[model samples]
Target: MTKIVVFDSGLGSLSIIKAIQKISKSEIIYFADQENYPYGKKSQAQLSKIIQNSIMLIEEKFFPDFIVVASNTPSLMLNVTTKKIFDVKPPLQDAKKKSKTKQIGILATKSAINSKGLTQYIKENNFSKKFNILKINGSELVDLVESGKFISNKKYCNKIIKKVLEHRLSQNNIDVVTLSSTHLPFLKSLLKKQYPKINFIDPADIIATKIYLKIKNKQSKKNSLKIFVTGDIKKFQTKLNKIGIKKKVNSLSS
Candidate 1:
């Protein structure tokens, strides 16, 4: 089996897990560093250290064939250096290439917005001149997703949607909105149901598709899944159970 490791800060990465499971028979190890949750508020030096330590920890523990950094806040740091073990195929890259309109919106966390990584990725892709990029900090929206109620909570989603999109959705000029955070993809259906006018790009889908393409031919191997967290296993299980994840999930300390 093609063993894979998924690294994230919280339940947000579960969205990534959902996508990968659809097309791959490979085993997956989900490592949730809840001890370092809300990666948005961290500094560049701190993120650098976190990413490095995470890579080392996963390598020492899981030793999987691939590592997917499903957290957008952390993935923002992927571009600055050439870290070979893990990479994020963000939809923003694909959206910039495929979208027909010049006006585009990137909705992510405050950390992602402030990270020079966004600017670096944009310029690295030569998206500096032609496209008008609108960056929005959807930090509160992320909290809603992490709260484990966004799916069942419509009124809350609607209110947050308005707070997030009403002003921008009113404009006819924008064509695509990239949900840069992995957490944001879970709310795409709700967003689409409300505003059918603009297209939403999710990095989770893009990353999952890429992973499938890489491991699709390796089905001859057996598949397995294990989840790890730096915090309470019961709490993680409770959150996952709310979303129908009833399987056994162990804590890092376990």
Candidate 2:
């Protein structure tokens, strides 16, 4: 069996894991650094160091065939740092060339948008000229999901969706809206319903497909999905249940 690890700051990455499992039979490991809750608020240096350390820990414990940095903040900002620390290319990089219109609009956390990492990458790759980078922070929505408040307020949800759409339209008529934050995946239906004209890009598919290919090619070992958190275990489990993940969860400290 092949082993793959998927991680994010919290339950958001579950969306990625779910997609991957649908495509492959590899054992999966899902880790949520819930103690850190939101990686978006951290500075690039801080996020890079924390994520590097976590990767090292995961490697020592599971030695997964491949690791997916499912958090947008880390994926966009600490990608290079993580690669240097772990000596692996992130799966999302494989999907970059396939991007149409070259214009990428990212919906992520405030920290990710402010880090300018994705913007810098696009510019450095010369995709900046062709790629119009539009960014919107949806951290509040993450909170809503985690707190179980999203379902309670339809008006609030619509307001947020409208705001995100407005940002996309004002930025450059984006061809691709990258759901940069793991939490944004939970908003897929709403996004599609609100803005059917724009194609929403969730890196989960690309990342999951890459992992499946690697496992099929016998490039990585197989591992089981293990979840860890640093917050209320019951609350975390409730959120996971809400998202349809019924696996047992574990709790950890920083």
Candidate 3:
């Protein structure tokens, strides 16, 4: 069976995992590093260390064929990807192509929004000088998903979404917004409801397609999943239950 390990600071990993499962029958090991919740708040040095340690631990523990760093915060802030390791980045090229207004928005965590790497990445991917890229800090929205408020409280989620996004998106005339953080996709429905004209793009499917193409021939007949959390197993399990993930969540060993 093709074994793949996917992980992020908290519930954000579920978005990427769900996308991967849709196309491939690879055995997935999902690690929710709750102890390091909100990788968006970490400083560049802090995030570098946290991501390095997490990747090392995941490699030592699972020895999977591929490892996905499912959070855009660390993915954009640091150089973490290798041959087998994959990191999520904002899909600026896709946004540019789809954007009729030539104004594209990147809804990412605070760190990613402010990261020089993100700016560089945009410059590298964007071939046209005509397209304008707006970076919106979506850390609060990411918190909603990690804390299970996105599923539990739609009213509150809408409030936070408006408070965080409405003004900038409306002012910039951005027709397309990239859900740069894995956690942000959970709010897609609400975001669309709020801003009907905006096209929210999720990079998960693109990432999943890349993985599927890489291991399509070796995929197992059955899709199996194992979930683990690094902190508060009971609380994390409760959150998972609310989202209809009944699979047992094991405590990740230190």
Candidate 4:
């Protein structure tokens, strides 16, 4: 069984890990740098350094066959640098040729949306002309989910859905809404309910598929998973159980 590591800023990456486990047989290791719960607010230099150090640590201990950066902030901030440093590529870069509409809207944290790294990436890739990037701050949804408020707060959930739809509509000709934050997938049903006409793209599926493809050609011993977080273990465990992950959960000191 091949080993794969999934790293996120918080519990949001659980969505991605769930998707991956559904489709693949690989052993998974899930790590949440919850002490730094919001990578979005960090500077590019800070993000780069932290991500490099994290990757180095993961590599040393897990020796994963593939590592998935499942956080949108880190994905956008460190994709290029991580690839260069680790000699690994992200699946988003290799996603199928997008539709000609060239319009892309992102639903991420405010910080990620405001990042110079993302802006430069769009500009450098010439996506500015073909793609119109729109960002929606969905960090609140993360808090809600983590707090176990998603199922109970129907009105609030609807409000968020409405806002996301409105934001997407504001960007004319947007054909794709990038679920930039890992947490956004939990709201997929609500998104479709409010805006069935719009296409919502979750990078997790793409990332998982890419990992599957990479490991397809390699042979390795089977592995299991250990989930670590720098937060309330009982709370984290409850959230994981809510999402159907019953793995052993560990708490890390901040």
The numbered model that scores best in lDDT is 3
Q: List the candidates' TM-scores in order.
A: 0.89, 0.81, 0.98, 0.81
Residue-by-residue lDDT tens digits, candidate 4, 91-185? 23422245356555666776677776567755665543544556567667666665556666767888866665675565577656767777777
Decide which is better by lDDT, 3 or 4: 3
Ranking by TM-score: 3, 1, 2, 4
How high a TM-score does candidate 4 get? Answer: 0.81
Residue 152, model 2, lDDT: 62
| TM-score quality measure for candidate 3 | 0.98
In candidate 4, which residue pairs clash?
1-221, 1-222
The regions of model 1 sitting more than 4 angstroms off are 78-84, 128-130, 220-222
The global C-alpha lDDT for each of the candidates, from Candidate 1 onward, is: 0.76, 0.68, 0.90, 0.67
**What would the per-residue lDDT of candidate 2 be over residues 50-163, giving only the tens digit for each residue?**
887788877887777677777777767765433212211222343355457665566778887787676675556554365556666777767766665556675688787786
Lowest lDDT block of 10, candidate 2: 83-92
Among all candidates shown, the one with the greatest TM-score: 3
What local lDDT score does residue 172 receive in model 4, on the 0 to 100 scale?
71
Minimum summed lDDT over a 10-residue window in model 3 is located at 123-132
Candidate 4 structure lDDT: 0.67
Model 2 residue 146 distance off true place after TM-score fit, in angstroms: 3.1
What are the per-model numbers of colliding residue pairs?
A: 1, 7, 0, 2
Write one digit per residue (lDDT tens) for candidate 3, span 82-194: 88999999888788789999999999989998999999898889457888888899999998988889888999999999999878987898999999999989899999999
Q: Write the per-residue lDDT of candidate 1 for residues 13-74, one digit (tens) a residue.
A: 77787778876677888888887877777887888788888878888887778888877777
